[model samples]
Target: MAEDNPKSSVMKAGVDDAKWYWLAEGWAPGGHIREVDFDAQMRGIDPLFEGIKIVDCDTHFTEPADLWTSHAPAGMKDKMPHVRRIDGADQWFVGDKHFGSIGGNVIAKDRNKLLGRLAFQNYDQIDPGSYLVAPRLAQMDAMGVWAQICFQNGGVTQVGSLLGLGDEPLAVAITEIYNDACKERMDASGGRINGMGTLPYWDKDLMNQEMRRIADMGLKGITLPDRPERVDSSSAYVGPDGKVSPFWAEVFEICNDQGIPLNYHLNASLDANSAIWDNLGFDQKLPIHALLHHVGCAATLSNFMVSGILDTYPKLKIGLIESGMGWVPFWLEAMEHQLDEFRTRENRGLKLRPKEYFKQHFWVSYWFEDYAPKHMLEEIGVDRVMFETDYPHPTSLYPGVQDKLVETLGQHDYATRKRVLQDNAAELYNLEI
Candidate 1:
């Protein structure tokens, strides 16, 4: 953490968190916890989900500041991803180059602040569960969730920035440490928290090696760059005229053969960083960014639907993480309609329709949408859908996950609810729960 982001006393026994910095007026996590009652909330939701171990297929683990530097050798320690307080914001840096602020926080002491909490001025103000494995599991337990597939929250492995530094070793170290940290967090969580792997995607050889390593280490899946050619226009994956060549074939094959799902979290890639307008205020841009992020996932789905990747590697599973499922039916309809109208040479070669491809290979996760869960689960394919709570991020389904569960999934039959909330993800990630 940065100098100003003081270390938390959360692990300190009986420390009285209500008196803690920036926690609520009477905040105590295990006790009263101000006005919060997770047990009561889960009790309300229990009949529908009594025996089910709900799988939150998409949540984020905010990386601790030492995630990289602690593992780096002494000489390279200062150069690995480390935080420094810059302009009153805790920003990550690699050898004085600014990565970005660790800006995913919008929770405090297990409380959701969508209406009251505006911004996290420093790391200390954020929830401990955001970065800690034990607390994350506790958070899941409190919310009536059994397991979570976690992604890197803070955009630390965007890779383009690491590649731009022209230091391949540093880039590799950053990626390796992130992947290593993913495995570490998974192990520490007793498999309740499965962190997805990342890759130094500009290099195909390195990417292939890391995928194998991830599979061997039992990391559930990997998040890919939607366009790896954009990482380095001169890399081997970059063909003539800066077009992407047959670079992603091995990735698809490995994922298909190994049964490793390719998760697209729709963050720091797929045009997500550019989704928000420059003029909007921080809070104003927050929601607009997330809404547009779902649109990016829609584009990703459309691309894969027509790209022939699914047809070629028919068994590969795709996860649209943190992407709500309400828009998918309409998007697929629009795509099928366009395919019918355009009948181009390329469109003629696409063996399956967009919706067919989606049903065959892709899986999506939804959070905080009532109509979709209640009325449209069948439309979204309950077998291919899962639940998530986004967890501590802005716009996350925090402080009311059980409420949301009861409101959205409560009406469904037991089997349907089990599939959406647990079985799909358990089969996908092979989580024991």
Candidate 2:
């Protein structure tokens, strides 16, 4: 059984993909696209960014249905994730269990904004740029973006469902297919987009081999589960131990040795704030959950700050993707206070305080934020902060990426602006452009 969350809990009726699928009825408060001069924006770079190539650190790449099947080894094709039109929505499935939807794509093929609870419902409705390489490159130029770090939409990398299917060989194959496709996309786009890779997180042997493979293959980074206990199981990863596993630290050491960044895109865990959803209806709860999910990284990252993992692997670079930067200062302050109040730092034998570790080991991306950009960029460390437009996803800084870049970031001095908007990402991802 799949995790029945708001995104994938659509009433299940139909099963099987289509020669072409019909669109599902959209959610309430959806499809309100702002009127913008689409043609002009697409013509060329925005003058405000006349000389800089902005890097959007966080964007979700909608995986094509054939992403795995077409690329699969002849024997493994049927076992990979395939899209089935269920109740009019395109849902991913493996064997019999459900995976997840083609997550929150708010951009329409016709270029209308379909945000908030509103969704495209199927591949027929999304922009080609959201998935295809050529259009993605063109849009990057139009939006004055140099490169983007993309994650898979719905596949093995997605938490829970894919791994819960409980087959290790199938999971490894699924992860490799996505990573291989990312390399192809990177080469095809001339390095304009770098899709982060995922490992078979449930197994240490597979995780070790895959991490090394991606590094040798020149993959920029790999998305890891911040909560390892939930992922590693007796059938694959390990039994009994969860978060406290020494194996987790060993994986970090491999990443550090390979100079591979460890990326933990916001996962569904440790969110003290999501409890507010118990009272609201799905549509009402959706937006708040999206916001809370981003802030939830505060818990994930802060936990690592004291985990002594980074203290062991000091050179390991970690990224908290799609988690906005607004809550960082307050969260760091809160963390430091607890460390001081309880004297945990002295006991932990910490080399530095929580803030120091955050700056040293972690990097974060932001979209649709003002206070952090307007006031807190300095506090967050310009070198550690990067720009993001969740691009195409609801709440992504879509349509107005160029306008917003100029609006929020234009006032800063050129060096600072370039660092936040472009250089930090280039440094983090080893992006050539």
Can you give the TM-score per candidate against the true fold? 0.84, 0.87
lDDT of 2 by residue, 1-433 (tens): 2232333212221222211121233422345666556776554556766677788888888888888899988798888888898766777778777666766677778776774455677788778888888888887877778888898665435545545656767777888888999999988888888998887665667767887788878988888765554433332112233233555555677678766787877755554343674766655766666667676677778777776666778888888898888888889999999999988888777778989999888898877887788788899898989888878676777676877777788788888888888888888887776
Model 1, C-alpha of 27: deviation from truth (Å): 22
Highest lDDT: which candidate? 2
lDDT of 1 at 359: 86
How many angstroms is residue 61 displaced in model 1 relative to the true structure, after the best TM-score fit?
A: 0.6
lDDT, candidate 1, 331-410, per-residue tens: 98999888888873264476788878888888888887878888988887989888998876656777778778888888
What is the Cα-based TM-score of model 2? 0.87
Off by over 4 Å in 2: 1-36, 40-43, 233-244, 271-274, 277-279
In model 1, state the lDDT of residue 260.
88
